[model samples]
Target: MRCRGLSTLAAVLLLAGGVPARAAGPLLVNGNGDPLVWGVNPIPFNPDRGTLGTLDNAAAVQAVLDDFGVWAAVPTANISFTNAGALPVDVTVANYLSYLGVCGDGLSPIIFDTDGSITDDAFGPGASNDILGFASPECGSFVPPQIAEGVAVLNGKWIDGVDSPSNPEIPLADFKGVFVHEFGHYVNLDHSQINLVEGFDDDPSNDDAVATMFPFLATGTSTPHLDDQVAVSTLYPAASFASGFGTITGTIFRADGVTPFQGAYVIARQVGDPRLTAVGYASGARYFPSNTGGPPAPALRGLYEIPGLPAGSYTVEIEPVSHFFTDGSSVGPLDPPAALPGLPEFYNGANEAGTNPPDDPTQSVSLVVTAGATLGGINVVINGFPPAADDCSAATVISTVPFTAGFDASAATSVASDPLQSCTFGGPNQNGHSAWFTFTAPADMTLRADTTGSGYDTVLTADTGSCGALTEIACNDDSSGLQSSLTFALGAGQTVVLEVASYNAGASDVLLFHLAPVLP
Candidate 1:
């Protein structure tokens, strides 16, 4: 993740675990191809879970209701929730599991884990770090999977002022937002990625730019984003939604054009007002039957559809999901999102989109969409630009010392590097658009390898031995402003592999690397 400033940073953390993908769709749909929603309108919930940490029971109940109201207030969505009072018996951590019976009970229960005991009992130790709250479908059908009943839990330790040495308090105001975020999942809405710079930049002041259903929780995003509103509206659209909004359908392809690129993010930005954009779609957003032991649906990978778009002229673009948004913090349909070897490009009016070498961002065509009309065949073919040394096995060989080399990482692809490598503070340890080089030491000496003239922020790592069996020797980030330099000793005949990578995703620059022996 990118960090612009330390003082401005907001509390941000990982969210729920991965869910199986079905045709790349964002909604949690049933076998019948419908989003699993409350069959009955005005979903009822038991919010009386007693006092939650420092917050009173009434405050906790009101907070949950306020979160539900955030979704219910969407003008385009026809969904609501009502308080069904308390459960028959007080649900302590010991008895909460028994209340979570299979099938619909009509009463959704909310639990307050004051001491995080419930989280430890439910998910195991240290779960509170990533889990502020979670919602699960307790009662549902498989044939046409519908959520007849559900339960939600909030980690009260997050708001309780008493800070534990293990789990510190996550600002009370920010903790309140988790309820809103978890509720989005309760209503079957999946994660959406939009204005992703906020998530990647580590600037929580602009958290409102992200969707509430975003895979991670960021401070200030308590309210839902336009994408979140659209998601809920699409699932339970009001009468005017279908007639007042438009849809765009397209396919994302590799440079080959034949191969589809699943998990690519597609955004439809309104021509003049970019804020009025329609996003939150991964290519191929449909549910497949194979996941439920039924025959698979027709191939829909790389396909994408963005609905709830108001009639307007918009420009569409495609890029890979942020690498940071993975695993427990995954976005779209694919967990641990795919690192597509495609340049970020805008959709130009090309007869053969992806086949072209360069999809220039400056050259784009504005497409006018009509309300209720489904615009099809907006296929975008991404130009492949994987760097020659994208992998460690293909490391560029450096024959001599006191060497300087040039690199263009604009369209480079990032590969997995050793996790144990030490990176300095002030930047993410992970490398983006990484390129590798191998050097065989001719003599015993101490040498300094640095990206002294890199146009963008760079991180450098050096390791000994082969790619599979290697020991990290040195790693540095921001040794110099927006550049990296590290010194290490190499024995005669020993080899070292060096990795130079961008500090942030999609960050590119013409780089100049210098390697020279250090003299005492």
Candidate 2:
């Protein structure tokens, strides 16, 4: 578990008591095994930095104790935490650098940044003052590594509530919520994405998620949500955890019925309470297929597992990551919808995905699960095409010239951090979340592909032939002020593939995929 930086500013007051989040998506725990033991140093590592809403020594330390109690109360988890007493401050060390040494030393020290010194080291100097706290873990490998120790870092700018109520910058409740979140990382849980409208709206129109593991939570929440419990139990399951829970294993398919749909999101919601949902992804596959071993298979790529579920009647819901992409740092809505396209559906045996409207629960399939039994073959199919092309194989069938479409890079993964097709206009590897579009020559023609007025830095690439065997035609890094553009010639009946990506990885930009004919 590495240190997770705050997604948005620290001022976010995301809490709504006792309401479990709908998406308890896991980041594939970084530890080798489960049941990590954490001991928080009850002392303040750094003196107050004197910011607007900093928590004092007594209040800060107490918050950690109270927050740890939240997780300690989970019945199914074998995890237990201890207040390890005050940590000895390093006299030789002047700033937050001293606390950095504690992460790998097998000591989980809950530290407070008296000033912005620690944050400056974590992000950079003069960064935003919004981040309240962070958790650092020892990640040996890229995916699911052994977590050695976790060090929690809190911003000392504002002495938050319960410490000093008069200084009303950040309430004590908010700080406590932040502590529980970072602590989730401390114990080996990772971030998850749930769709909810942020800012001034207490009620979300889409899906309102309020889990400790969610990137951002609603304000006034204190306890661990149901999804969080499922994750913790899976990580550190007790004796009854096994007998009390069941597992769901399944695969996802494309409209063609062959291509393995990899990145789609699948959830099993309790028939009794839809909000009590457990989520996983059909992710065993990568976007790019390899020819070395053999061709791709559905079982090899499209697989999902939702374990530690309570034995009950449940309904399965499937949705694409196109609208809500999980980036490295945060998870939330993708850049405004760009015909990203994937019909969300309940597993009712048919393909046209649909959700059981929030009011109606019996509208979908009610899957029965017995404790310790794995229900398999609950397959799903996604048929609708994205407004833009999905890949060279299923490129959007386009006929109109100067066509406009949308692109989202939140779900993008870096196959190659560098440019794969061209170098001249190649920008950053933002191409990780690349989108595809293809067109056949109306009659020998030249066309220009442009992503202008895009919110983020954009890049474009052109190719010919199948995705596995692509012939790069042209590539551009930046041409229209942080946007991307390129021109290529297309012969009659020749299908040219166009790719749109961000200049930086994980950046979702709202823009048009404009393909206009090049006039002499």
Provide the overall lDDT of each model, using Cα atoms, as 2-decimal numbers: 0.68, 0.53
* Cα-based lDDT at residue 17, candidate 2: 17
What are the TM-scores, per candidate, against the unseen true structure? Answer: 0.71, 0.58
State the lDDT of candidate 1 residue by residue for 1-520, as single tens digits: 1121110111111111223442223345443344455666888788745677798988888888888998999988999998888766656678777665434455677777776777767667876654677664445544464566767777786677876556656777777677887777666676666876555445456666766666656666677777888888877889888888898888888878778777788888888867536565887565344344334344466778888888899888876665445543566656556655555677887654543434564467889989989889888887655343677888878776555545557677765654434674554466577778888877776778998756788788898877767778899888879888999998988888988877755477666666665532
Clash tally, candidates in order: 4, 26
The candidate that wins on lDDT is 1
The true-versus-predicted C-alpha distance at residue 79 of model 1, in Å, is 0.8
| lDDT for predicted candidate 2 compared with the true structure | 0.53
For model 1, which pairs clash? 24-285, 25-285, 284-303, 354-381
Misplaced by over 4 Å in model 2 are 1-54, 90-94, 101-104, 125-128, 139-145, 158-168, 195-209, 277-301, 322-328, 331-341, 350-364, 386-520
Highest-scoring model, TM-score: 1
